[model samples]
Target: MNANVENQSPLLRNALEFAKANWWMFLLGGILYILFGILALARPASALLALAVVFACFLLVDGIFSAVRALGAKGAEGRWWVFFAGLVSILIGLYALFGPVNTVLLFVYVVAFQAILFGVSIFMFGVSIRKAVSGEWMLYLTGVLSVLFGLLLLWAPGIGGLSVSLMVGAWALVIGILRVVFAFRVRSLVRNT
Candidate 1:
């Protein structure tokens, strides 16, 4: 029993070390999301159009990947959903790419739906983290923030869409930056630990 406790302690300590190293990356991502929201709000119409094109490009790439994966699929019959999702994503992308500015509603819907998913993911992570540490309230706070933001997005689809797009853009920008920062920070961890 003493040996087991000693073994578990290092594992838990290492896990906490990992989380500490990564937490700043997530916070940076949140900051970026806030900035994106600001940008989208600045020019909703143009941003919407730009976003649609970006999504279209992603869908086209995703479709190509999905089709390739589908072709190589083995006995996994459920692989059809991947192909189907890829097709639908491609079609939606094309529609948004060519459709008028009024098609911005699609963008709005995507933002709201993404918010809900993000909220749920955060909430689940928070709950799980609560079990890991006695005073890990930050996760809970983050989860609450995520859920609230998601709900707010759902409540106002148009504004939510604009907000979410900006937020997500900012988030990606921050996350990307943080990842670069952390990459440098982890050099010692890579070498020593």
Candidate 2:
């Protein structure tokens, strides 16, 4: 192990050590994420509810942490802002927990708006780069597709919710597989070392 460490660059050695130590965490997280993705894909309605509950819990915890940090940071600049943000997060968390359906709808609306804004930005970028970059048309195409998808979501938010769930599921599954692969790779590194 010492010889192997000496042969590697300092950054690579540290990263390998970190990965060796944390490989189990990656494996566990990957399994959990894969299960979550499967469940979300199999039942999108349930996924939405689960997502809302999870988000609420996360917000509550984050708010509490932020509030504590703000209170602990006596005489620190912008501490009040942190407290204010925490309060808002707590309120929103409570609302989301109690009014899940409404929260989901709101999330869908936000996603729609975000997609539209993203599409417009992409389109603008494509236009800006038209003169300097070839294949700018691909960006324009992607922007158009994004805009159309957003418009469709606005037209039917129920479908949008399902789409969001599916997308989240697919993303989670892909990330889970990557993590699992990484865990095995790290384990191999440990063995090699």
**Candidate that would win on TM-score:** 2
List TM-score per model, in order: 0.45, 0.49
Where is model 2 more than 4 Å wrong at Cα?
1-5, 55-102, 105-159
lDDT of each: 0.48, 0.58
CA shift at 19, candidate 1, in angstroms?
A: 1.4
List, residue by residue over 1-193, the lDDT tens digit for candidate 2. Answer: 2225556455444434544555565576566657766877898876786765664554466456546645654543344554665666577667667764465677666445534653564465445434333345654664576577668667888766677777656645664665566567666666766
Residue-level lDDT of model 1, residues 70-95, one tens digit each, is 44443333335445645655666566
Poorest lDDT segment (10 consecutive residues) of candidate 1: 1-10
Total backbone clashes of candidate 2, pairs 3 or more residues apart or in separate chains: 0
Clashing pairs in 1: 32-170, 32-171, 33-167, 33-170, 33-171, 36-166, 37-166, 37-167
Candidate 1 regions off by >4 Å? 1-17, 51-102, 131-136, 155-193
